[model samples]
Target: MIFVNILISFIVIIILQLLGMVILSKMTPFNDMEELNKGNVAVGLVFGGQFLGTAIILGVAAYTNSSIWYMALWFAVGYVCLLLSYWIFDWLTPGIKLSDQLKDGNKAVALLLACVYIGIGFAVSSLII
Candidate 1:
């Protein structure tokens, strides 16, 4: 029962994070996955930033002052794990220079990437948790 509860809760977190990324992507002017995949710095930063942001949100939610918070805590745990996955991906994907472009002030690309990062983190975390 405990494992089932954890699994369901983790799945919920992944879905919510994906939903959030989709919404965030739509809000931005640019929506090019190809461009985003081409090592755009903006995308990388957003990817990294969104995970960090989601982790914090989840962390706070874990405090469990309310039903919403309790649910959020489960998501938070999954998200942190997801963030670790990102670090692993970065370490593994050597020579992928997205950081340079991010420093060049590219908002559209960044927003797009933020979505991807969060999406990946959410997915990975959901699976493991």
Candidate 2:
């Protein structure tokens, strides 16, 4: 029974992570996989940060919630918060369009945005009771 429960949790987490990635890909103007294939380091870093951020949130959610439904709910909340942080970062940096800069292969912008996402992930994870 314990093994089955663990397996289910693992599968659920993987599904949620893939869903998050899909949503993120839709949100961005450029194709992430294509850019990654083109050896765009900036896109790779930003995507890496997103993956790590979601994983952190999912980890906390799975650890804290006993019910699968509750875990999914909390994961959704964390995912929204993670998405909002990107918009907030854009808002904070006036007159600079983050998505545009990222599409243009700006390494500095990507690095800062990646840091913002990861930093927000850490902060949000701490709040996930």
Best-matching candidate per TM-score? 2
User: Per-residue lDDT for 1-129 in model 2, tens only?
Assistant: 989999999898889889988888787888888888898888877888887887887788778876788778877887898789888888999988887887788999988878877877777788878
Q: Please identify model 2 stretches exceeding 4 Å from their true place.
A: none
* Model 1 lowest lDDT segment of ten: 59-68
Q: How much is the lDDT of residue 95 in candidate 2?
A: 85
Q: What C-alpha lDDT, on a 0 to 100 scale, does residue 119 get in candidate 2?
A: 79
Candidate models: Cα lDDT each: 0.55, 0.83
Q: Could you tell me how far off, in angstroms, the CA of residue 105 lies in candidate 1 after the best superposition?
A: 5.8
Error of 2 at 69 (Å): 1.7
TM-score per candidate, chains pooled? 0.50, 0.90
Write candidate 1's Cα lDDT for 69-113 as tens digits: 565655655555545544555466576333433545476645655
